[model samples]
Target: MKKYIFLIILMGFTTMGLAQNSVSGTIKNRNNETISNVEISVSDAVIQTKSNEKGQFEIKNLPIGKWILIFKKDKFEIKSEQVSIGNQEQKILDIILENEEHHIDEILVSSVFNKTQNENVVKIDHINLKQIQNAGAINLSDALATNPGVSVVSTGVSIGKPVIRGLSGNRVLTYAQGIRLENQQFGEEHGLGLNANGQESVEIIKGPASLLYGSDAMGGVLYFNPEKYAANNKTELAVNQVVNSNTQGSNSSVTVKASEEKFKFLVQNNYTTHADYKTPNGETVVNTRFIEKDFKIGTSFATSRYVADFRYNYNDLNLGLPEEEIEDSRFRTPLFPSQKIENHLLSFNQKVFFKNSKLEATAGYVFNDRKELESIDEIALFMKLKTFNYNVRYYLPDFGKFETIIGFQGMNQENRNFGEERLIPNAKIADIGFFGTSQYKFNKNLLQFGVRYDFRNVTIQEFGEFGTEGSFQKLDKNFESINASFGFKTEITEKITTRINVATGFRAPNLSELSSNGVHEGSNRYEIGNPNLKNEQNFQVDLNVDYNAEHFDFFANGFYNNINNYIFISPNGNTIDDNFVYDYLQNNAVLFGGETGIHLHLHEIDWLHMTSSYEIVIGQLNNNSSLPLLPANQWKNNFRANFDVSKNIKNSFIFLQANYTFNQNNISQFETKTNDYLLLSSGIGTDIQMNKSKFNLYLTATNLLNKEYVAHLSRLKADGIYNMGRNIVLGVNFDL
Candidate 1:
């Protein structure tokens, strides 16, 4: 590890060279008239400038390479263009903006090449902070469910996990602040444990991304981009508040930031408290309340040749377990059978710029403490996890029309338990990987490909027997794998584009799946691990087509995945201390799915918009049996109108939405079918100007029709409990 660290630093220093690049642009309207006061920003760089009265803007001291420029202004659609800069060369660009009547395309930062939405080889979804706030989501998982090809598997409202393409748990990877999150995610009841208040935007990769992020990315990746610092020589402050009726919950947050020419800093704090959520029948689920507190701080320093950033985040959660009956109280304090989780994370990122290339490095450390209580004053289980990760990437000099990247990533983790009940024994894990990827563009067609190799080692400590359960013996395992991918994107016609990709991914068995020999408290079952389990491998193919016209947009995405040695738990027709006995097993499986959507805007009534989307997925074992916890087919439709109530009340809009979930009869033998249901919801939002401050106000209603329904993926469904319903939310945000 020390040698690797030294090598990375040496490479950064050796690649240093001197170069000066500048970009100048003129912004105009559809009528070819120069427009002023447009905000222009360069991607992955700390340069932002506004257009002068002559509609001209210039950014200097930039790296000599390809860059994406974004132009934005009020009442105008956003525009992005790709530009390349040579050493000591001044590039000039002309940009045109249309009226804010059509949906604007966003640039995807998570892609290997930082391509635009229409140019990416794989489908990526973007959800901005503004949209998350408008939806009035209480957690990260709920906020992400608004996008197609995404769903939430929940033990309850406070314990929801993200499911993508019929895969959850360790199959999906979550990244925040450019670091992979590892908080004992092998359990079904483990939530994301991330706060959405301080995030700028969330990007979802819809398919396997093992080439970029080594393991645990077989399903996809959820990248949470932090909010950027204030513009140069500026200071800003903001506060937000939200209230929910169903849970009697309140969320409050505050943020402050300042930036100068060479340095910038930001800080944020958030607090949330809620009571038991109520169902459509006005029945309160016992022990369903939760409380959370979060704090984050970040700072950065930038020079002509180097940039360094440091960030720290702290989160504390008191989540209640909605299992057996307890007190039906509306207080914030959790009752018995609850959980307390505290997480601390620190990360440092560095970038060294050369004349034609750049080197990036990131190091992160995370500490997680989890405690579960079965009695009011006694702890049932306690586990502590500590992880250190490092990543280094070198961008090779631009090769004519090609871009190349070589990277190395590694992680070291330790897990220990100090409780009466041991779900998983003490374990240590280490991983290292090396990969290289490249992109080549010719005319309107782009080609992308990559390959990676990874090695992992795991060691477990033996533990004593518990009651009648067998003892767990010491184990050591080593795994190695190689994966690759190929993709292509092209514009089929002036108004249509298509992308095709094929990728292979793999995952090693988690400690819980290989070491556990007792009853799992979260799932209420006796799970016996398979000590000799092998690694799981998958291969997937994806196809996406998009059509963009003057007044409408349409998209279609399809995917098929095949897996070998897929591990799952099945009942063994036995019981241990009244809990059903389940054994970890492996089988070959196949999953196929697709999502389709369309957005329409009326040309005559520019303020009127309509959207409709449908998604379905099927997961089956080699024996023709359905997989467990598969999401049902769902369809969503929305109608919205935007208008100005008055000069002070600008950007006013109201929307009505409907969600239809079809009956899920395709299930495993241990699962039950869920009935079909339709849910109605609506919301209204507007901007209010008071003195020198602008405030955003929104009101949203969910499950407005009060339909009593249970989602097929809800963990509480087995207990005959319905999901939350008839929720009313009100929120206010403002900058100071």
Candidate 2:
């Protein structure tokens, strides 16, 4: 607690230092046209801002220093200004930002889209491409975990899903290219099939968003898009390879794109094969569970203001359970349950932006298919499950600070699990919803309201033989539920903001929770069906205070979630079938928790920089014990330094980054507590420009200390099994 208080106090003083001065300027081109994206910064802190398309920009929060503002655009002479921020009211920092159109070595694209920040919308940090490239990580989930309100824990290396506040799986909805994956339609054990290599960005909307998405989105929604759409008559290809110290093997991928005015196409291919990844103890935990190959191909067509897209993703992985459970032959023979994933999506988007009346419409179809336990005799196949979503938005900027979005969505899913004694046949479920969202800004105070209604239905077939007959069971019947949200954001000052959003959401039972009848070899558990199930509802409120200044940035957010009818498996007493059996059943409970992060950066020293970030989470089940699989309180302290190696070397620089994670100790039923440990990781990267292409090299070393520690969510069987060991990775980023 003292650590938290001291950090807060230090941040308060930083906020006080933010009230310094302001500067404004105009940037125009050689032809007297306003030039956009002219990088302008004070001193060399990289506090960068760009001129608007009209070449106008504003800067603030100067802490009384001899500041020199530098403005430079590609092919243009670099502009410079030396002035003091010390009580200078007569300072007129105005200059024309020019453009040098003569040096056209290659095509350069600019991002001209207007970015709007509305306090009423509660838009957290925008995970832009720049941030993604700077924060070297293995995947999107690991990258997004840096955000305060979001938490991520892997079911294994192959499965990592984000938890908002304290909700995930059934409570969350992930979107790509305006389409929802709908695979989380089942449960948390299943992983998302997205690769971040060719991704544009991932937006984490952390609140009750069912008003636009439907029942599957009780917690929030995550949006993913392509990095860049190639222009007509152009082609871009990128190849990436990554190696990590924790996992000795390297993963490689390639993405090729060709686009034109009427049509844009992209093809992405990825392959990763790892041997037994070692832990600090020099032993392997997750067996052949490592993945070998995955592929994804996508294409898009745009005309006027309308766009259409299609995508397909496939995964082939040889999976295995923990060494402790190796006695279970079910996973040894059927070739250790080789798993495959196939996903297909199709969608269309149209926009009408005329006058103050703006209309946007989107519709899409998604299919998530998985062949569970396919390598085993008693195969449990989850066939093609489908989902359909649609939305319509109308914006009226002329209405002042008032905006509204409304839409309707419907989803239907089917699952089948077979066995020799009896074929469970299949289970079918559906969700239909209607919702609305409104935002209003008054003075410095902002407000937003949302509401949603969902109808759920589920049916199961209980057959006796392979094709034998049994009475059909309506496990979960038609259920009606509602979700609502209201929030407020207030800018206490030009540099400080406080925001809070309170919402309620609900989720009806899914197929897996209702009629799963066979063994899940991956989890090494034989799951049964539950005929009696109820809807789970939750009401949560989040409070955040953010402060940004000349040399500091900090935010603290707290959330409380009250959940009821939590569908957790109960004790099925005891049962011995053809093989040694485990006991489990189904029951209901309540849950609550919250997550927060605090980051601080020390003043820079020459080419060196120091920064630290801390994250902690606490939660309970029935308001009693901890929530299983919840990420423990941890912290990452990082130090980086970059230096100019030489001038003739051109793009020459060396950077070193080191990070450490603190202890995590929350454990639930049947789970053990894990001890804390430290990790040291470092990386160096550079790029070499060529005549027609570019080559980049990246080398990273992880677990430098070889410290042994186990993540609370690591799929490895208990006893504090070491999770990572010293390893080095080498990769090349080639662009053609």
Report the Cα RMSD per candidate. Answer: 2.3, 12.4
- Cand. 2 TM to true fold: 0.76
Off by over 4 Å in 2: 1-120, 128-140, 146-151, 184-189, 231-234, 244-248, 259-263, 292-335, 373-382, 394-398, 417-425, 465-476, 517-520, 525-529, 578-609, 642-665
Question: Candidate 1: global Cα-lDDT?
Answer: 0.85
Candidate 1, 1-736: lDDT as tens digits: 6535744663354343345567887899989999986988777765566788999887765666677888888778778888877677788888899887667465656778666676677778888866767866777898888888899998778988999989989899988888888899988876988888888899998778888888889889999888777766668888999999999999999999997756889999999998999989999888888999999999977655666788899999999998765866648788888999999988878778766788888888889999999887688889999988888889999899888999999889999998788888898999999999998989989899999999999999887854346457789999888999999989999888999999999989999889778888777889899889988899999999989887899999999999889999999999878999999999999999989999998799888889999999999999999998898999999899888899789889899999899999999988999999999989999988776678899999998899999999898999999999899999999877
Model 2, residue 539: C-alpha shift (Å): 1.1
Encode model 2's per-residue lDDT on 1-736: one tens digit a residue: 3223422432232112223356777877656777775767543221345677778766644334444677766446556676655432335566764433221111111100111333234544456543344444554576677665566756445556787766677777787766667764455455667666666666676765555666656677777755555534468888877775555556788888886545667788877655555777777654545554666676654322223455565555444434445433322222344445566666655444333344555566677665555345644445556666555555444346666666665655565543332223366766667777777778888788878788877766655443112223445467779888888889899767888888887777666566555554545455565556667777777787767654455666666666676666543554324322233332343444444443343445334445555555566665566666666655555555544444322333344444445455566666776666666777676667676587777666666777777766666545456665777767777889
Candidate 1 to truth, TM: 0.95
Error of 2 at 98 (Å): 15
